[model samples]
Target: MINRNNWRLVKDYIKYRAEIDQVSAKTLRLEETWLEHTLNWLGEKSIDQAPRIRPVFSDFVLSESENKYSSEYLRKLVSAHRRFMEWVSINKEGYRHKITPAWLKTIKLPRQPEEEREHEFVSYDEIIQIARTPIKSLRDQRIQAAAVLWFLSGIRIGAFVTLPIKAVNLDLLEIYQFPSLGVKTKLGKSATTDLLLIPELIELVKRWDQLVRSKLPDTSYWFAPLSPETGTFDRSIKAVGENRTSRAYKDLKELLDRSGLPFHSPHKFRHGYAVFGIKNFTTLAQLKALSQNLMHSNISITDGIYGMLSNGDKKKLLSSFSPATSSAPTDLNQKLDEILSLLKQNTPIKSE
Candidate 1:
């Protein structure tokens, strides 16, 4: 029987599988959770011995894939285990067949469709109100500004949390989102975005940047986490090592409660950015260009996510058919206008 001591092998693999594989941060945590469940099931069986209970593993994998776990989650576990077995064989001889990669080929995943939730729009007034309110402390105000900038700029949270102060150019009213700095961008295409257009937000970001730079080197990260150590020096963006967005989300909810505003997370703001830009500033061609700035593949992706018509907008469309509606073209007016124009041309009418 596999005792707790033998289970250490599974735990060891779980710890390093993601880092060794160069997986995403979210992916690493998930694999660790799944491995914990699988090891519990194999309480007494050794790694090499466990898969002889191949039937048991198979049933558990399938059930987990179909039930508690989604298809995405199931696929990740299978991948993690396959890599774990490969690691075991190279480091600790004679466990090569434990993974039996063939079983992974037969595993089916629970595929979820693209998320269809509508993007929540934050109004200009709401932004101004939040800016005016007191945030209890300077740190809270910094978090609020970060949240606002995420919505205002359509920048990714991953890039947002790690942005260095040197990357910002407030004098030019621009932010070097990608190519200008070490900040990672999708496809690595970087462009500078104007920040001066939003004066209030510019003031907030300037204050935050000044506060951060006074404490850190110009090369230091803009968003650093709270340190538990007394008098420990703060680290660079990469050194902080944890996502600032999760805590930002929690703090934002509390801010909303005090402000009496409805809550919407940072991602929905991204969706709002796409839809809002389309609705206001431009035509379809212009919209495609804006969507490109947002790094979307096609205008259709922008339209699909942002252009679902609202009930109020639909009501306006339906109201346009009424006789009193000034927008409606009248048949009598069209005929009269045509006749008057013909008379002005001095055209003679022939009797049949």
Candidate 2:
């Protein structure tokens, strides 16, 4: 019979090890969730019985992979068990041999196919269409601004949820994604990114900025919740407690439904921004600039993630590069930059 004490020990070890690794609560919760399934699969067997259950571990991983879990997700599940086994071996010496490298190696993780890894891109034109096909109230404007900002800045949805109005400097045409300033960037990554060099996008964002500032504190979220009675942003909302990603999704869906455009998630905006920017880039500096603007660690990482181009895009782009034709118009690029600069000057020091 399984010893209850041993089962509890393994559970406690997961929490302890997760904390030492400094993983976020979301990640820790995932680890715990996957491990619970592992325990259930090993029903009636104590963790100390790990040596006898080694084959079961291998079988379980294979079975789970065969059920069609994505390779990345399967890898996480395998990693969760590996970490737990490593912890059990160190903390509970009797199971050391069962959890050794050789035994753990028997567990197979699924490989993610290339096609399954790609995200659907939401085009800049489509975002503008969604923004233009407006609905009633300040809430509708907030949703439109959220969609525009995603394409304009390529900020992750998590960071966008907690972004403070002060971090978006319309005057400078820059967004400061700093954790110190209460922007929940990935791993607390901080960067100052210039807004997309599109005059219409800048104007759209400026209207949103002015609308929010008129009702809420600078410290409040750029996408702050609206007050039902006042039909303006609720100044009393807390800065960081709530995660509004789902609410953002619902708002976007409402807009898309009204506009007769198929619904696309907020994350698709990041993919769209990367694809649009990379496809139009004429210089290495411009390429790297896009990478930095998206908050990617380096150019290679950006390329690796967003490098895949559709065959249609490839054929059209190659045909445009004729021997008789000169390089992309430098004047057009300069004009774009100049328009962005003109809009930046309108950003008042205190955003009055």
Candidate 3:
């Protein structure tokens, strides 16, 4: 068996290829994490042990450990290993490879059952109420603006955190996702998304522009970090990310407590957008187009992710005889707005 210490070359190869091939940083990060973990576990201390990796990596991910990682995480680990090793065997000579995941048994993962995933967002009233909530400082207001932008645009959170200032077109009242600026478009393509309708988000963003970007002198970086003393932008490379996502969730949970409602996630805005599209001013073709704009490979992919309709929505689509009641008009309207906004605008989200 090859020693474990020689896996750095493979890791470096992945990182290097990902950079040149325009692969998503998120993908590279996951692959690197898995490779590192597997190498550490197998006592592989160097890059020379490329061949011995497949079995240990596969077994560790597929095996049931006491800590019990989620099936979904294991799936990622499996996929990353497969790609890296595949690259290794092809790029390097005679690295004995025996494992292939295509033949492996399917991993059973959790399905949304009776308690389906929610696509909830702040209601108009809730938004208004939130507006009235005291803002102690500029940062609080800025974060609130960022949150509202996600809801208004139905953007995925991943693209929003990395939003550069130039990607947004205040003149057009839209934010376009551009991969060149590291904006994570649906399939890493640029999208000019509609964001004009949200007066609240717009006004705050404009204020932020005057206060932050105007002075920061960084045209390329939208939503750059701000300094406390100057209130101008900072390029510390630290901004809203997964950790911010967790923090946002905690804050949202606190808000939910005040509202006496169950907490939802940052991703639900995307679902809200889908439900919105299906309900108002959107046809099947339009849905597919929207999905494509969102970087989905196919409309069916979009449906697979956000197709679970609410009971009320189902009843409306089914028939009057069905048990499901149509949802309230206003509730449906919000969903529709989100869908249409993203569809019509095709603007970039800042969550890269």
- Kindly give the stretch of ten consecutive residues in candidate 3 with the minimal lDDT sum: 103-112
lDDT by residue (117-214, candidate 3, tens digit) is: 44454444455555445555555656556556665566777777667777766777777787777776556667777652557656766776566566
On residues 234-344, what C-alpha lDDT tens digit does candidate 1 reach at each position?
562355356566867787788777788898776666655555565565333455455555766555565676655555555776776666745345765764565455434
Q: What 10-residue stretch in candidate 2 is worst by lDDT? A: 343-352
RMSD of 1: 12.3
lDDT of each: 0.62, 0.75, 0.58
Model 3 scores a C-alpha lDDT of 0.58
- Clashes in model 1: which pairs? 1-44, 2-44, 2-45, 71-110, 179-190
Q: Candidates' TM-scores? A: 0.59, 0.81, 0.63
TM-score of 2: 0.81
Ranking by TM-score: 2, 3, 1
Best-performing candidate as measured by lDDT: 2
